[model samples]
Target: MQLLSPTATTYSELQNAYEHFNKVLFDNALPACLITLQREKRTCGYFSAQRWANVEGQFTDEIALNPAYFAVTPIVETMQTLVHEMVHLWQHHFGKPGRGRYHNDEWANKMESIGLMPSSTGQPGGKRTGDHMGDYAVEGGRFLMACQALLTAQFKLSWYDRFPAEEHVAHGQASYASQLSDPAAAISPAQANQALANVVKPTVKAARQSEDGTSLQAPNRSNRIKYTCPSCAQQVWGKPGLRLLCGGENCDSIPFV
Candidate 1:
């Protein structure tokens, strides 16, 4: 894997990571709904964090892990976090609303599909991108603590509600606290618009190097992932067995890959 200099992770660089990882996860058969990774605050784990956007039916960015918590986060923990968040995204898009996103048989089945288990928190269970899910069980504590201060008093409620419609909207804004933390909301609607244009679609291209040093370009096929904008209901394509786009040029809704 290639190390991205702190200086190199500009918005464009972030977009590249978004494209690359979406393709990677999808190609691996665990396609996510949406993904973004940026240097944002109040998120835990790695240099980034991820969550499901219920209202938008996609996954949020991998918010960078605060430097203070990096030591304990193992590779498996990070992969679990990614898979966990992606499963939530899948539920939001493909599964019915009002369904529990975690701690249920569906979650277990999804985790199993990805070689993970909800009960495997910090315990030996399955394979991930690497072997290290225990890191979150350790490192995630501080982030949860910090998030308590940065997040709303009812952060749990901020995620979902029993009402299917409300649950959808609530999950869409997991980053609301982080967005508020921003001295400036540097991620503009225009920039988000640009990103929506570049999400993966079925096409053949030469294998190209990602910041992570892996090549993500893949062969085109009919079974590619498809998405319908939760906001607009416009159908679009993604990495395979996943959706990638919304209708409007400036889509604030979540996306998958």
Candidate 2:
């Protein structure tokens, strides 16, 4: 695939890619959903099963891509991240069981069936994590082949300008709040929470709160837990078992603690 100028990728571009892949790779089995560009601190991408009412007052599914993470990544790798999350969306809609942050056996089977093999180490044939695994697009896999075909067809994946100025810009350097001016950028967490409130009832909230008044948030991401790279000591805010790799280009091979 010809690598185009690394200009900022827009959310519309992401949606285009999602649609193309959904039709070609998934035979268009997946339903329509919201495609967004998120400035997530840790993960490369995310798929939410929780439905929410958008600004138009219509409920929709959500798939969020982290611009900060994908800005420095290769386009093919970025496509892989999108496909990976699509698998999650597929599982959620198809009744595949997953516990918390773990990518269970059923999920793995589905991933493999779609040409992605999960590895905790982000390498082909790396150590597996029980029945669950994470990271790395399998080399010579069906997903890779499909991406290659798309690239051959001259599909251009746009990049997102995660920063106001490109100077001294490395990956994951800008904060989401600072770059809300972009129309295609994902909604901020506060906006997401507000939107979710319209769909998720208060009874669900009561069940998640602790006796001490603290609320149990998402499984692998919480204010109480922090992820730090053992090599560079670059700390990212998230819970343990999040599969967070060091954001440093050179130290990315090292998993965060």
- Estimate the lDDT of model 2: 0.52
Q: If scored against the real structure, what TM-score would every candidate get?
A: 0.31, 0.56
Residues 1-257, candidate 1: write the lDDT tens digits. Answer: 99655545433433343344344443433342333432222223231124446676854533332221111122223233444455444544455422221134554455455443334223334323332222122222333333333223221100101111211111112112212333222121212243432332222222222222000112234433333443444555434333244437666645521
The worst-scoring run of ten residues by lDDT in candidate 2 lies at 208-217
Q: Tell me the RMSD of model 2 versus the true structure.
A: 14.0
Question: lDDT tens digits, residues 112-210, model 2?
Answer: 877766775345565444423444545566776777777677676443333311111121122221222322222221122323212211111111111
**CA lDDT, every model vs. true structure:** 0.31, 0.52
